[model samples]
Target: MSKIKLRPKSPVRLVATLTFLLISLQIASIIGQYLAHQFSIHRAIDVVERRISLDSAFLDVGNETLNTPANRYAIERYLERLEKVLEEKNLPVVVSEIQGVRTKSDLTEFPRLHRTTFENAEQTISISINSRNPLNEVGISWLSIILALLISPLFAFTSKKRRAQSAREEIVLPPKPRLVINLQEKTISNGIDDKVVTLQNKPLCFYTALVKYCIDNPNESLPPHKDVPHELMALANKCFGRLIELGHTKRKRPDFNANLDKTLSEIRAALDDVFTGYIDEKETYYPPRAQGEGSRSKQHSYALPSIKEDDIEIIGN
Candidate 1:
């Protein structure tokens, strides 16, 4: 004989199982309701029957019959039955017992008179209706089952749709790119000349250098600069724009800005030192004066090396 293996139920199946349980519980509740209805109907009928039996007994005995042992015994039994009915119905019931002399006035009170005569007093029993709803001869358990059958499938379908949508989103969407900007260093490379420059170890490619060069010489362009890529241009613009925005802010932070400006000035000085061939020597070179003095003459030109089509390169204009 071969053994059959059962597979574990997945999440959807588990949800379906729970739905089935709910439907079963609802069916049970419906069955319970019908049973309760039948009980109520039976109890009401019993109460009516007891009241009729007591009336018949009173009719058989004479109205003038005083509180004799037999009469009292019958009355006591009636009271006990009425009490039991009251308890079962969860309410009060009133019944009237009149024992008097056979008078025309007394006879007017009850149309179907039984044992009325010249008597002493009246005994009263109040019959209060517990409820007006009629007996439920048929059970509606099948309705609950039908509703569950209809709604459970719909609920499962909706859940399945939601789960599928979530799965698709997980598969379709791309993960975000991680940005790690190390501002400590930067390097810029001129693709045309194969020259490279670094600032705090951050790369400053042709586009970045061009942006800086533009900032210094707004009205001029780099003579032998290579074409800038779109991505590089955007990055360079973002970097330069942040500094420009900081500089334009109205907030006063003199020392902070001063230090930042000094660092930038040093970077420019280093670039100038490199261009002037003074990067190798530890000493600063001071060009000879033209034997003249002016407010604007303090500025000195340091010519950048020029590249020609031939192998021999020219320096200074």
Candidate 2:
């Protein structure tokens, strides 16, 4: 029987997995803290309820005694003692309102945590705690820390496995195709193959001017708009003059500046014919296409970007 083998994960997949795990753990931690705080609030309310129920003297007091100002002050003092007890236990609760006895003016400013009422034939007492999510009341347990520590080693092991797999499956690509611009023949060729693309006088001059400009200014892209730069136009005119001197074209000097976009499209179409079915070579030799529909801004150079100046051999110029 053959042993089963699992494919190694990519770096992107590993990173995504780590990110998801971290986010999940953070959400779980927040939920746990919230639940712990809620439990503390309920526990504090229960303590208050038990103390009020156990106060026989207050419960047995007549309606007349409960209505008196002195009795009401004593009840407020007893409630303050209960607040101290809760604070000592790290609950941090506040007695905000008592129905028919006293009401806090700023009760609406604080969130209401709990409310309860105690009633008998003699009188009724209502209490409310208006403090919520007290600081330092909820804590992360040691168990959660231990769980995180135990899970970290698993993530490390998975990350190492992915890296090792990527190393094992690494691919080596062939060298980039070279471009050769022959000015004398007015031809462009991919040096890897015998395939050559011949161009007319004006198109050849425009293409060669752009290529030479790219070589000189390797870091800059041509303007995205229809307007050509003065330097590029000058370079194109110089190439056209050279072609005319070489007797390649009998026609007079053509306007290189007029209809510049149409000339760029013609140059790109010629390059496309030569590098057809070869996507990488086409990308290397072809002029940068427009980015989007009606978009004037160019993100890439108007000339060959992938081909380096060292790789391009310009002859007869």
Estimate the TM-score for candidate 1. 0.26
Candidate 2 lDDT over 150-179, as tens digits, reads 565455434555556688788666566666
Model 2 weakest lDDT span, ten residues long: 100-109
- Candidate 1 lDDT tens digits, 1-317: 64434444466876776578566867687668767765764565466546554564453233334543225446446545654665576632223342321212222222321221222233323232233232233345556766676665544333545556689888855432111122223432222333444453112222233333343443442221223334435555455444345443333222211232233344454444333433432121111122244212334221112211231111110
**Which residue pairs show backbone clashes in model 2?**
none
Evaluate model 1: give its lDDT: 0.39
Q: Where does the lowest 10-residue lDDT sum fall in candidate 1? A: 308-317
Those runs of model 1 whose alpha carbons end farther than 4 Å from true positions after fitting are 1-75, 80-140, 153-164, 177-198, 201-317
Best candidate according to TM-score: 2
